[model samples]
Target: MGMLGNTFDIEQIEVHKGPQSSVFGSNAIAGLISLRSKPITDNFQSGFSISLGDDSHKAVKGFQNIKISNFLKVRYIIDYNYRDGFRNNILNGMIDSNRKKELFSRLKVEFHPIDQVRILGTYINANLDNRYDVWSPDNNEQFETYTDSLGEDSQKTQGFSLRSKMKINEDFNLLFISTRSNTQLVHAYDGDWANDSYWLDEHQFDPDSTGYNYSFYEKNKRSRHNDSQELRLSFKNLVTGFYFNNLSEKDDAIGYLFGGLGDQADGRYDFKAYAGYFQIHHNVAKKLKVMFNYRLEKNMYKYVGNTYDNYYGDDLPLVNYESENTMMGYKGSLLYALSDNSNSYFSYAKGFKAGGVNQEPNLNEFERIFDPEFLTNIEIGIKTIMNNFGYVINAFFGNRNNQQVTISKQRNVGDPNSFYFYTANSTSGYIRGLEMDLNYILGSNFTFQSTFGILDTYVENFEYELIENVKTRAGDRETAMAPKYTASFGLKFEKMDYYFLTSASYKSKYYYSDSHNKRSSAYTLTNITIGKKIKDFNLNFWVRNIFDVKYTIRGFYFGLIPEEDYPNQLFESYGNPRHFGITLDYGL
Candidate 1:
């Protein structure tokens, strides 16, 4: 990802490191990112910012805050970004095969009707349009693609949320939040990545469609909607977790834009869920505290689909399948105050990932669903602060069952030349890691911080069928995307009205597929920023990937040509290169 520098409207960012499903449910398996929005001030405020960079990249953002009355206030934010890409399409010789464009806006309102009551409302809208060209041969440059067709990736999201806070009593308070959100994604690409002329001249094949160059064009769509409500009760030294429901339904389709052979495919995943959670925290002794939490949930899933092929006719019977599960999760912890500026804690947690319908139904027995997943985790940590310096150290271990793993062979349904991504359940796995964070300050003029992480993930038992004749031994193998080593270092400087910041991060190599046969090499990146602030106005210059290093974001094993001619090959989607940009912000 590229950096756009900091604007005037940002506050502190919070990062969580462990499994967050105990509080956030199933989606926080790895971790979670939380941004603390700036508070609405009592006075009127407005801000504007713009950024310009290499490769014709540009960004414009603005925010407005209005104090309508003593009891009401409103704020809104809008941002737009565009980039003319750096990669070239080797087949068509056109640049911007990897361009990006995005638009986002948010509105927030705060209302205070009574002395002890407060209400907040927020609405967010976002749209994204981008080009993706990643296919290439091994001998090509890093910034080139071999596809002869055009592709587009587009997405949009809309959200609305309401929150209420009330001081119920002196010793207890209540907080409630309700949200509704939806997201839609559309992906269209060339199925074969080769023009008809190439196929006709080299392989002596002709199709019915003659107006276009592509042999096959495919478009896919996915959409999701969610409605949730949460209520929290806070006491003097305790917090509460209440109830959850995930009545989820999926409507997805894949159809051809051209051609008749690879015509259409449709799929669906419908599910319902309900959960209840409870927690308690209390001081057991003078310097020690004990906490306990528990949760239980019920999940029901149904699968429905209609898949077709020209040769095989229909892949499935176009019927409905159902599965259901009930699971429990718990957490217990002990915390002790070692000193006035130091503390230590030990925690144990259990998490769950409910089962879901399958995307690919080509199995022998026609099993149409994967089982739910569960995890057991334990951790011990210490935190200390001494005037100008602070540090946190932690060690963790986790055991997992029915783990979900997605392996992409890049074969699209109905079309012989596209890609279909599917998820399946793995038997068992374990994860162990160590992490440390350090922060130091030098007389309010300089600040330094660093984080280091070491992780090891392995599957204990499972076997995955790669093809009709080949199956990968998935036992005792390292998991995908689990880099063994990762670290980041950052420094911040401030003097009189000027500020400067620099950061360096590193990640070790990791595998991209379930077979563990292919991997990405280790890489490091550096970024720097120098900015000046004049009261309500600010300006900055920044650069990312200063060393111009090459890295991979995604990789796949697939064949682009006819099955009889070319075998499956390794392909990669590369990371961004060196980028430099300047930003200006004004506040009034």
Candidate 2:
């Protein structure tokens, strides 16, 4: 709720089922996030907003725009926000406050050099600064004493993109898109080791006493850069149809050392990928339509780095390695209209997520190479509209092969001073699911919508020697944070003067890690908003997480720690608690 920003509104969206990978990429494996933006026209527009909320969080945001003519336009947005965290540093006896600040801007221009040709260009930039702490400790226990030295971390990201389109003729067209992104993170932690106190006392702390000894202090910094480009050409008619698309991407990263009185450790990694595909759609009869698509992709990786002295000494030379992967797939779909407002369709598709280099080489000199995982999906669905009511139902079954899994192990090579991290693909798995949605309007002022999805995921095989014992017990349900069921509902009331909205989301229980031993409970969250418009001004109040549920969203595993010694450091990514805020906005 709250202001939700221009990209976070849920009520203004409608859910749809289709093979989204064709357009949005592989991350849409579960589903797609559809966002609606304000319409663009040759007009002047501007708006501003301010809010105050729980945890001492305050926010101010505003945007201004202009139409320099029929061919040029510009828009700018700025937001200043601050918040105090809910967790307390037990050691330091102070609130673990989290803070964020962001600024974003966009510019667009259109040019028509000829009667039949046009060119459009756009530019956007955004910067984000986030600071937070890792609340939970190595043992599944919470720290009552929080320390400023124990909880400090920050992350930053910036990105930009450009796209262009050309009309070759009435039946053919061409398009090109390019994008670049950069991200960086720095983190440090120091605290008392309740469980690892004995090991720290002898190795990390003074051997004299256990009372108030500085236990662990270390820092990690990482930087990533990504660049991508794509081009597409299409031609369609009653007969002889053609479509082709191609894409290429490059990514690189560097890791830096931060603390621990230890020598800095560093690593570099890079990957490149190329893919191309062609598809055709045709109507063979008045009642039937058929489509076919085929695609192929190749990926390569390079890595270099030295393990930390605590894990591996400087005597060991940094390793250099390379890997390559390739995949080919095809898909087909059929559609038939039963009536003017009703239609049914069935589709079959296959795809793969490319494998990459494992730069964290800790102990063993062996290189890790994970094979590409493949997915085959079969789905049938129907969509119908009757009067003011509409409904969509879909059922899908997917099978995945040779799934990649990461496992952590400890290794102390020649030097007694350092430690190294080595990775390998250790497991295989499969996933299948169903999804449905409905919408209805009860007269002119009220509307309702609902959506539901279910996934059944499981492990198929475990073949690694290091984790054989743990893998045997890992069942089909222990795979990652994927929930078995997810659902949401929304209600909206709108009129000439005022508007009201309410919605709720639910996710089924699932584990945070591959071990399948640590599980997170199921939870439901609700939100509400009310707003009024007067003249050219608008005001609204919103409440989120109405029930104040305490739940974890994610967890991190420290491979250095022995499993028999303690649980994987169960650092909980806590869900946001109950919060309320009000916003005032003016349009010009």
Candidate 3:
């Protein structure tokens, strides 16, 4: 649900895997991504693109479409990008400490007064500014950083949407949708990534030890709002829907801003949802088909929290919470039609997730409410085409109940950056998976592709306690970044307007946290592309990580070095090293 503009103004992209929550509801239970954008016809079009790279990368993108006659149509899109951050902040010599910037704009409209009605509208504007001085005390210096407060990640977003389609005469059909969004966020960091003469050489024998003079800063300001509405109806084989949602959030947090001894917090959250859905398909003969789906949801939540702790000078009280829940989801399927190309299927699903409230800031009462998690899935699939080759395969099994696990807490236990994070509820879990896709065509200009996956995740018990009566158990771990074999392969070559491509990807070995047992060590990446098309003008060249492989996407296992007095290390973040780019395009 976080998608805005430009994939060349997408026309379609659909990916659904496991648990669609009986037709898109509640986080989709880890599956679902659907987007469709390009529409607006009747001639008139335009396009543009430009890019250049190498640390100081820059880019520009565009699109346009118009036709305002018999029934109105319009479209426009824009994108901008900038980059200059390869990280080399030797303490403020400022090489744009991890820089990046982006802007996106979009607008679309279509209306056909009558002809059985149709209307569509959309508008969006976005901005994302990023810079977060890559944490380091040394992960073998991937690029480099010796921060003294230099970090930020920003966001600004605006959105709107409306849709409608009607044609109720020849056997029912109607649809409507509405959406709204707003987001503003800023995240700040630099919690002693080292500077200040390395804490005065680790306090050289107590040289005014204000705990080795640490300096940490944190800023978190966020605001979010969302609204949604949907209605649907269609004849023949049934389809029905109704949904409404509203969400609100606010947070303003500040922390440890150096000696003023700070730590302030404020929070508010609200959510509401209601749903009704139905789907059915039947034709159990001549190639077989059967399907059924159902959904019912109701959820409401609210929270308020406040805190202040100027180095423990008190004032940590004032909190309120509320919750309600009722959820149900279902699906069943069976399909077969193994001729005209091929097909096969079998499925079962049930998923739900709702129950939250952990705006962290000193919490107890089971770390401030957390519950509600469920998933059950079973699947089997197959698809095939034989002439030039095509294939797909899937196999899955899953089970989880009350699982949601994320835990962290540390406040001045010698200040390992005084961490805080929460989410807990783990009682059972299981997962199994297999997936594959392949394609090949060689007669008219060569192409080949492949994909692979296999996974297993487990965590059977978790009896928690961070510290307080000390109790712990995490029976058989292995559920943190869950990675066990993944692969990709590609090759392409075209003959008409020149083209070439190469790709590679792989991953294995993972575990960044189930709260400790750091691991990550399997990586591969390769990419290359070249293109040319001289009709409407197009040119391209690209290279990415073609041999520069220094992996680690994220890792953090505590300990902030006061000469190892804070031991438990393992801090990393590295990905993206080799890159090359060039692009130019023009169209009409």
Number of backbone collisions per candidate, in order? Answer: 1, 19, 0
Over 210-245, each residue of candidate 3 has an lDDT whose tens digit, in order, gives 544666778888899999999999888899989989
Tens digits of lDDT, candidate 1, 425-502: 788898999999999997889999999999999876666665554666665688888899999999999999999999
User: Which TM-score value belongs to model 3?
Assistant: 0.33
**TM per candidate:** 0.89, 0.81, 0.33
lDDT per residue for candidate 2 within 213-253, as digits (tens), equals: 33344556767677777787778732222222232222222
User: CA lDDT of 161 in candidate 1?
Assistant: 88
Best by lDDT: 3
RMSD of each candidate relative to the true structure: 3.9, 5.5, 24.1
